[model samples]
Target: MTACVTVLIIGAGCRGKHYSCFAVHFPSRMKVVGVADPHTFARNNLQKIHNIDKKNVFNDWKAATERERFADAVVIATPDRLHKAPAIAFANKGYHILLEKPMAVTPEDCKEIASACKANNVMLAVCHVLRYYPASLKIKELLDAGAIGDICHIQHLEPIGFWHFAHSFVRGNWRNEAETTFSLLAKSCHDIDLINFWMGDKRCLKVSSFGSLSHFTNSHKPKGAASRCLDCSVEQTCPYSAKKIYLKLAEKVVNMEFEGGATAAFTMMAFTERLGTRKTTVYGTKGELFCDGSGPVEVFDFCTREKTVHPTNKSTVIPSQLMGHDGADYYLMDSFISAVAENKPSLIQTGPEATLQTHLLVFEAEKSRKENRVVFVETRKEHFP
Candidate 1:
């Protein structure tokens, strides 16, 4: 019989929804036994959507971990600030962890979680999903094959769509810098990881970044605009009106599963209701990749002096037509499962190498922002070792 790992899901939000989808897709290897969330509505919605045993659901992660009811592993998908407590609680009990990124809001908290997981001899995989994408994997392969030839400076930008930025950073959970780190930590961590992955063991020499609420402040608010998009006078004219772009996309976007046995549509709706845009770009010496969450994957290769557009592969069960960023979701989940089954570290993300690299970027960026000087990534001993 194939050994099945029973999994517990923490947090009933967006990431959790995706993880639940993963559980459903790979039931032979993993089983989602229980789910917990502080918000009753979110938890109930997940339970109903996944048809989870009501008795197995809990309002608190601590309670679920204590009982050891339904899992050998726990997926932590809570907000940036809430990661440490549940992660540590379950790790101490010997539960393997799939932790969502930014790891934690602070470097100290990140260290704590890393230390706890290490002490318990549990596998701690951070959800830097982009590392799992096929395009990124292909990029890594090309880089390994010397496609880029000794990487030089990289220029990466996350085109956080205007409306998406407003919804998440300005009015949503990430709006306050204190709650989450800067937009770099909250939004660009994936890019940082990808840069590190492509940099191929090269330490980031220096880091300097400049960004602010440049487009979403009171000064930029349109005339007669209300605080929320629903009531804004410019709703019809605004490109990011919640109802126009995000809500419409939410309904049309493909549905997937996540950690807490929640559905993707539920979380998408929440994001649209809360924040309204998404787009990210990563540039390298050899090539550049761009994803707008609603289009084909585009790559510009300097070596070949050509551009390649990889259209969405739509024949799969999930219907690639609805898949975002050329079905990155499918590719990422498939890679993670393959890595676990093969008992090997992932090449793109989810390993100490990639995690440390990105965290170093975050650390230096925060330092640079505070000191108003460029900061460099310093090579350090592996946190896990």
Candidate 2:
């Protein structure tokens, strides 16, 4: 019989909810022994949803770790800035870790987390959920099969449409470049990782990026505009109004539902009410992918004149779904559980080799930006054991 892995969840936000749901789906082998978050509402929601007892709830992860907690592993879903401490604490205590994306806000911090996990023999995995997408996996398989030959270059973009950017970045937690790194680091780290995954042995060489608050800045505000979206003068005329986009989509996206983060709904609505739009583009040698709204994965192959569309599991054809990144939420969790149970390497994200490669791109990209030159990615020979 597979030994059930007891798990501790930190951060009760959207990502936390996804992890909890994943635990529910894998009850035979994984258990949600406890959850931690500063927000009472979020903690209560997780407890009720996962049927966890009040004693298992914690506002501080340090305290949770102190009691020789029930968890065999810790999932760090806290804000980007708070990742390091909990990750180090849990890893030092010999608890395996599942971290949210970008690893840590800075490369130095990523190194620390990685080193601690390695020294403690704790498995560390990052939440780069895009890799779990079946379509994404297909792309990787095709590349390995030499369908596109050697990858020479890649140009990727995340078109966080006018309102979406405003909600998440401008008015939301990731707005200021100072608060989050560049829009690229904060958002495009996934693209960079995918680019590395697709490009194979090729290095980034250099990255010359140019972007700004553009449409969302105070300088771009229209005449008689108010700070809040609910009372904006453009509310009636603007198609980007918060109420129009978020409230409308909330009827569909589960995480946006009233119980989830209705605050995210209102916050998104407010940003859309203010900033007009935002977009990103990524180009690679083999093919291209694009996303405007928070929807499905769409792929277009220039060389073969082929196109594939993979709808997120949220559509009518697949109404009921998991949190995190659609089916990706389950794919990653399942991989983690299997890796732990079998005492084998994970095929999905995590693992030192994969984490090292992913973080190297971030490091090189920053170097390319600062040095005003293209930085070549160094090749590493280690394979997952």
Candidate 3:
């Protein structure tokens, strides 16, 4: 805890590598001491890059947990369904945890993981990386300073682009809810968490969500369309053709809706032609705040009838490998490692209790979608206790 925080990389997939890269980029603050993945290729690849010791390398997370705690923390980036067991196991082993998003597949599992961390007195930082963005922090600061004059309504959108949807949802590991989790949790938890974060203390009393696999179902499949885009006669015309999406042969179209608010909040997530863009607008009594996920925060003050812009403070020195999601990934990893090194859970914004609450909001939205009814969210003082 005094020096660099030693971290065990679990899963060693895309997310695992992204989080582990922080150690590579900032060796003095963090170090990758071990890695575990069922796939030998993945484990070995990360091992070679991090020079992980052979004695500490593991075939699976359970094996890593079998040994006494050697690292100060563990980054659990395993698939959605596999989160609970490994998280609880590692927490019991006394390793502070940096769990990937959608803390677990179910509310019960998320609660249990949070409880385990609390009981063991270990820090738990969920990967709600959006909150770590400079824009996000600035927006929060402005809101806290009454720049927006008390958020009355918020509208946030996640445009997962048609190709991105097809790639990650239609044919990827997240394609089946039974295999992983629902689309909302798989793709939009970060959006939901951000909305919840901007809402500040205004508890979400009720939520109603509606979404479906309407366009992706077999019923919507074009006639004579082959199972694979390569074999399809209409590959050139099919908007979702893998060739078109992966190769960027076509432009994107996005779905959008906007309504002006300080108390009410809405989140729209879609896999349309809109490439991975996010737009957020928070309406307050005195002013309005807007961000397009890549641009500066725009604020319009009603009192002065003037507008001001706050540009994002980009981190240029960090290598692209250590950055993603508008450079929030690097900051998120740095914050979590700082928290683990200092044994101060509060150092991270997405601590167990805060993440648990936002995740509950997501779960409720999903329930509302499934049941086709408005679901009331439960307010909690502390999720762990």
**TM-score winner:** 3
Query: Which 10 consecutive positions of candidate 3 have the poorest summed lDDT?
Result: 250-259
- Assess candidate 1 and give its lDDT: 0.63
In the range 130-188, model 1's lDDT, one tens digit per residue, is 66665566555655665444444443334455566656766678878876767667776
When 1 and 3 are scored with lDDT, the better candidate is 3
Worst 10 residues of 2 by lDDT: 250-259
Off by over 4 Å in 2: 247-324, 363-385
Q: TM-scores of the models, in the given order?
A: 0.77, 0.77, 0.93
Write model 2 residue lDDT over 90-194, tens digit each, in one string. Answer: 998988888887788776787788788888888987877666655456555655765444443333333345666656766678867676665556665665565
Candidate with the larger lDDT of 2 and 3: 3
RMSD of each: 8.7, 9.1, 3.4
- In model 1, where do residues sit more than 4 Å from their true spots? 68-70, 223-237, 240-326, 338-348, 382-385
What TM-score would candidate 3 get against the native? 0.93
Backbone collision tally, model 2:
21
Whole-model lDDT, candidate 2? 0.63
lDDT (C-alpha, whole model) for all candidates: 0.63, 0.63, 0.81
